[model samples]
Target: MGFTSAWSISAHEDAFITELVPCLGPLIEAEETEPGARERWERWQTSGVDDDLVHLVTGGGHVQRLYRGLTDDDPFCVMDDVWGQEGVEERLFFSAFSKDWAVRGLFQAVGPARAALLPGWCGNFVLTSAEVRDTLPRIEEALSCGPLEKADADRRSGLDYLPDEESVLDGPLRMWRLAAQARIGLCGVSLVLD
Candidate 1:
């Protein structure tokens, strides 16, 4: 099976994990029975998570790559090893539970980048409102440049599944737009890429 990425935007991380995740099924059920619940229920259903703490930001594929490129200094250099080696993957998975492992793995994979950029490559991390604010313009520029096709071509020589360029940018653009919203509203956003 191929890798797919999903994003969750949330203001309250603790409540999201402890309270929201566990109650999603009932919430969806309750919403379904309401008069205008379909639209609301549909939003929660799309998050791919069952909870009120986080809203799923939906769009394209290769979001991990797009985010990395947008936030890193040597974006193209990291593209050479987009998925990373086995060791890096193991570390990335480990990072889910250990922040130390995440920091180490991020440095190893991308090499000497800002702490702010680590969340883009790793799972289960939060970006501050300032970080989100700073990143908005870069995300915009990356989307406008439309380099996914070339990046894909440069990263791999022969690939059977090539993603649509438009579709590729949609996810990250939407995610970042949501991040901007969260920042404007004075809330921190947590990014969960799975």
Candidate 2:
């Protein structure tokens, strides 16, 4: 009933879009030609996302590749409420931990402006292969600033917290790995909020 994150590695954005747009054609035509079709589908929709669409998308390349061969042991996994931004949570009225602060810290280490690019948990976005390669150095610099180090400092500063903090802190690292993999394959990283 909560959020489930899904991502993919694509040769390019248009490749996935080419796969997606056609899938939506029938839905659009149905809405126009069939009376009550829009209402019927809307009944199953939440926040403008059709239930059927999510089911279809989660099965395709744009969603499947990232999920392939993954297991419960993977820390930064799909299908969890571990993400989202403050604006989205407020507009949708879902009170959830977005990991915004945690992720933002990583980007903030790069520059405050880059932090703004952090997308909503359920937001669809892409990072091209070129982007992945280009951003590595800055991302590495950000990593050095200590999402983990900050956790340790917080503890030392008398702010007691859970010992499982490292797992949560690993989001950026996992993200880095994902991006790197995308780069290696000459693909782009696609986050599909389903």
Candidate 3:
């Protein structure tokens, strides 16, 4: 099984509840109106509602844990499941772009040429709004240049690297656009790996 990566939009708990939740409530309600959605909606509402809220806004997978308590001084233990850790809770999980695609396709296509970008080495990290804003232009430029070439390994494995066909860049591009929007709104962009 491969790891999936997504851009998560997060903010302090007060901001999330007051600012972002209202914006998403209508959308979540509308989605629930669709057939076969009631079960998922009820499940989300009853158990792990915060995670449900995150899934609702960013359109990503379940986020069992969100915040790190103030007393947790260790930066490496940011995801501890302590009771007070859920305070800074305005987080939203977004797209699930594969790690393989990020390293082999997107980074290779847009980063400096010949750079050995390794997906496995990229653990979860946060991207500030400013960082997201700065990177958007480069990614957009790369996308505008046209479809990217597949990794050499994919090519060697007899996979067709068609420029006109769908490539690995599609998912990340969509996620980046969303991240850019969140960045413009002054939200923190975190890259979560699963």
User: Which is the leading candidate under lDDT?
Assistant: 3
Residues 1-194 of candidate 3: C-alpha lDDT, one tens digit per residue = 77554433333333333443333333334443544345543554455343333333233311212332223462222243211247433233233354332233333343322222211111122344455566667555554443234344234223233455434345344444765775532232223454
Q: Which runs in model 2 stand beyond 4 Å of their true positions?
A: 1-14, 17-125, 145-148, 152-169, 182-194
Better of 1 and 2 by TM-score: 2
lDDT of each: 0.33, 0.34, 0.37
TM-score of each: 0.28, 0.32, 0.32
Alpha-carbon deviation at 132 in model 1, angstroms: 1.0
Which residues of candidate 1, in runs, are more than 4 Å off?
A: 1-119, 141-143, 147-168, 182-194
Residues 1-194 of candidate 1: C-alpha lDDT, one tens digit per residue: 33333222333223222332222323333333445434433543344222321122221122333334433463531222322324323212111211122222222222222222323322233345566568777556544334665454223312222344223233344555665764521121122243
Q: Is candidate 1 or candidate 3 better by lDDT?
A: 3
Q: Which stretches of candidate 3 lie over 4 Å from their true place?
A: 1-102, 105-124, 142-144, 147-167, 184-194
What's the residue-level lDDT of 130 in candidate 1?
62
Clashing residue pairs, candidate 2?
none
